[model samples]
Target: MNQRVLSGSDLAERARRAIPGGVNSGQRSIPGLTDLVITEADGARFRDADGREYVDYHAAFGPPLLGHNDPDVSAAVAEAGRTVDLCGVGVTTAEVELAEALVELVPSVEKVLLTSTGSEATFHALRVARAATGRRLVVKFQGCYHGWHDAVSLNVISAPERVGARDPISAGILPEVLEATLVLRFNDAEGVRAAFAEYGRDIAAVIVEPVPHNVGCLLPEREFLRTLRDECTRAGSVLIFDEVISGFRHDLGGWQAISGITPDLTTMGKAIANGYPVGALGGRADLMELFSSRPGGSVFFAGTYNGHPAVVAAALATLRKIRTEPVHEHVFRLGDRIRTGLSEVFAGLGLPAVVTGYGSVFVAYFMTGPARTYDDLLRNDASMFVGYRRRLLGHGVFELPLNLKRSHVSYAHTETDVDRLLEAAAAAARAQLADGDVLADVADASTMGGVADRC
Candidate 1:
């Protein structure tokens, strides 16, 4: 592989003049990297602006489950573009077909409402819950990121001390918006019971990620999940499973199918379209009908690009491929292999870290044991993990910039890629251990902004 002599820093400098923070998303900007500009991606690898190729585990923040630029999905999008570019006035056949596919595949989805992004899906789902239950408060577990909407955006990455407090991560979020949201510790059945006991009647919905990946992949205990379902049913509140990241990636029916705990409303995106900008809100027909543009019902759900032809076609192709192929099997096998290999590598290096996740998504926590809640994750040596991630990047393993974000294995990934990742992890661990004062060095690096602060 010949490297091209392109300058990523030069391109980033130019982008900073035009865009805020020189990136479209805040997480794209790494602390120590000169430039994080990706030029091309195919299968399991992506090429940077400098023409450096690396095995990508970021998966474009969990969208490219089939890997970037999959041939079938691209071909479907191209064919749809030739037929119809945009039909804003009327619904297209592609949209109709995609909705049918979603209804057939997802367990709780009886009626599907299309949206342009995950944020829109979550926002509308919350609204529908509010309308159905006639309540204003929403209960969200801490560390589970539904999206960047005002209602779900609060307390995403709050400090350990602010677990139950309504602390908004970003500025400009109104206090009233934060008040509507009740942040609870994940896997805390007692806390959930207490919240419902205090404000059960006023709660519109209880939204959760069945397998929370936002704060490094914490799986819910069976008791905790059942408690949410029981509590919501008792309180007449809608249970919204924000499966934006876990949907279709774990199974055809999402994690709900595996758990047999179907939510009243399900918000799905990311892997649903295999990198296309698409989202869906679906659940019990009675609840979903709140968003209907019919005579009596009114929820006000509208988006111009809700089901753009090309995007729908891409989603259709991706879903059909997953249905017929061994996609889940391949991803699961790779995930197990990677986890085992990484565990062995860390144990051999005498590093106190644990790999946590389910199915194809995983994260390396610089802690001795598994984390059950957001505060438990805060106990991790995040600075040390950031240094480890940077070292892996140097060795051609491109993980997401955030230390706590989950890394995914796409169907395109192979055993060879897993081996390469293990090799890089071993090398990185050796380099970190070479210094006697590694913890002190990591603490110093933490002072530099843009290092393991954001979720």
Candidate 2:
């Protein structure tokens, strides 16, 4: 093998001596491709340990909306580091300022609670819902990921046959925990209605990703979102929109602003701090007041780095830049270009595929028809998609290895970047088609058991 590839392999071997899977995250380890050990990143690209560069579409799992090493965010973090790195005893002014910015930007957020990670935010959001409603059950849609917490981790990427079953993707989660969570199909209003009818009185919260991106960016039908709102309202269940991936990528107020439907609580991370470690849970003043320590009952929510000065400073800078600049316009334009260009490439090649997503996020599925729900997404050929992704990696594009994971576009990407991506994609498609009748095989393949095989 090449010395550069050998270097990455050696690093992986060394990591495995200490880490569990030779990678901190299981999803980072691509099966066929060499493990990428990134040394540095700037703008829309990142360099591997071998000094080879690739246009980065992973964006550190959708956090670097402003792209890597943004000057403004870096400067703010540096200033905070020089002044106050950690003040665990009391709250800082920067934290208050960031909270104010969040409250102003998000429509449903009258109050904000800072957490260290998205998992913590979602975990606390469920807690708040339970505390407010005095109920035990939580309803979540299939393929909507709300962090790795046990409460919201069930049915993230389940088998097609296990659609309505509350199956935990990760081990060590108690079966009782899964029992408390009711999993339903995404964009299926009738399924939701049936689930609510069965468990409406016991449902404490119904959490959803307004734009379900985990299973390849399946957008919510208008009536579907409205149904969730109406059901949650009538059932007295807290409506929680897990906007960790969608927040600020499309608009300031998230999909809530675009859809004109408000949730009772919202969880945000990723783009909020532009790659910094931060998470926020915000919602109506009355509901958020459950976390207050001043008077009545309070849910136990606290973290050592809850409002770290440096992290808050980074968030404040990111939000301010997003507010003043044309970041959304730039990313949205490029996203549309890529989405449209890829669809055209597939059509020209006579490949069975479709692209679906919104704003700066997109996913290419190896199926012809529309992908509206989790079951529909399962019909795509995972093996062919994985092979295509591997070929794209070789062609100098970096995307997540997961079959239907979302690919992102950052503010740093330009029209030239989109052109380059489409060129590489077209080449990848042609190359994949050259290897026998792959398109025919994809079109004829069964979707049911393939999903189970993936797990």
**Per-residue lDDT of candidate 2, residues 1-455 (tens digit):** 66544577688778778888676654655555435677889999999877778898978778889999999999999999988878677678898899989999999999999998888888989998999999999988888888777887777777777777777767899888888988888898998889889899999999998987777688889999999999999999999998988888888898999999999999998898998889999999888888853356488878988988878988999988998999998999899988999999999999989898899998899897778888887788776676676567777887765577779999999888888889989987788768734433432232211111111
By TM-score, the best candidate is 1
Each prediction's whole-model lDDT (CA): 0.83, 0.83
Q: Name the TM-score of candidate 1.
A: 0.95
Query: Per-prediction RMSD in angstroms?
Result: 3.0, 3.8
The weakest ten consecutive residues by lDDT in model 2 span 446-455
TM-scores, all models, native as reference: 0.95, 0.93
lDDT of 2 at 324: 92
The number of the candidate with the highest lDDT is 1
Model 2 spans with C-alpha error above 4 angstroms? 1-6, 292-296, 436-455
